[model samples]
Target: MKKSPIETVLGILVILVAVSFVHYAATKIDVRPQDGYTVSAVFLKSGGLESGADVRISGIKVGSVTGLKLTDDYAADITMTIRDNVKLPKDTTASVASDGLMGGKFLLLEPGRAKEKLNDGDKITKTKDFKSLEDMIGDVIFLATDSGDK
Candidate 1:
């Protein structure tokens, strides 16, 4: 079978459209990670908090966790990258939070009222350590049993 000139042109148009659609899709789906300043915070326990986790403020995403390591004091040191526009106060607090009871972990940043802004490579002084579910459960059970014995 022989293809007509109109059919050949239509096939070429379809291929061009397909390629354009693919390029557009690729651009839309490609999320380039933000390049920003790094700040460290130490936590007693990370509670499964890992790198690439979201760093949110007021429930809005403003940054992300970039690195995690152990400190000499046996604590977890978390490095976060905050956007250039978001200037954090020196007294800002970093806490590990979960979306829900069984949800994934994220870093929650609570802004402080201090006049001094945190600079690049500065350490966040106020950090809330991550509390595990097992620890909370144990505490609850202890409280209930103790009350019952009374």
Candidate 2:
């Protein structure tokens, strides 16, 4: 069978479009951590958190989640890279949070006013555990049913 010139042109056009789309997608996903220092925090629940998630402070992204692991005590050990200029205090707290009910997860930082500063590799001691919607519903149901138990 002999192929037409138009068919050959269409095939090359499709390949070019696919390559361009792949390059666009690759550029949009900026997951590589910027130049920064790393610190860790332990959370009882990861709450669907994933690596490359944004780390935000007061609604502004200042870092990113670099690693996630399971600790010896069965907790979620999260490592994050924070911007060099954003120095956190020893009393700063980290929490796994979501943007909204239908949105993705992020690590929220609440910096505390301490004279001392946290150094690289220091583990944050204060952290708020992630609470899922099911947990909140269970708590409500328990209170509603246990009102007369005691």
Report lDDT (CA) for all predictions: 0.92, 0.93
lDDT of 2 by residue, 1-150 (tens): 999999999999999999999999999877564888899999999998998899999999999999999989999999999999999999999999988899999999999999898899999999999989899999999988886855
Worst 10 residues of 2 by lDDT: 28-37
Alpha-carbon runs more than 4 Å astray in model 1: 1-30, 148-150
Q: Best lDDT goes to which candidate?
A: 2
Q: Estimate candidate 2's alpha-carbon lDDT, on a 0 to 1 scale.
A: 0.93
The collision pairs in model 1 are: none
The reply for model 2, stretches above 4 Å from the true place, is 1-32
How close is every model to the real structure, measured as TM-score? Answer: 0.77, 0.78
Clashing pairs in 2: none
Worst 10 residues of 1 by lDDT: 27-36
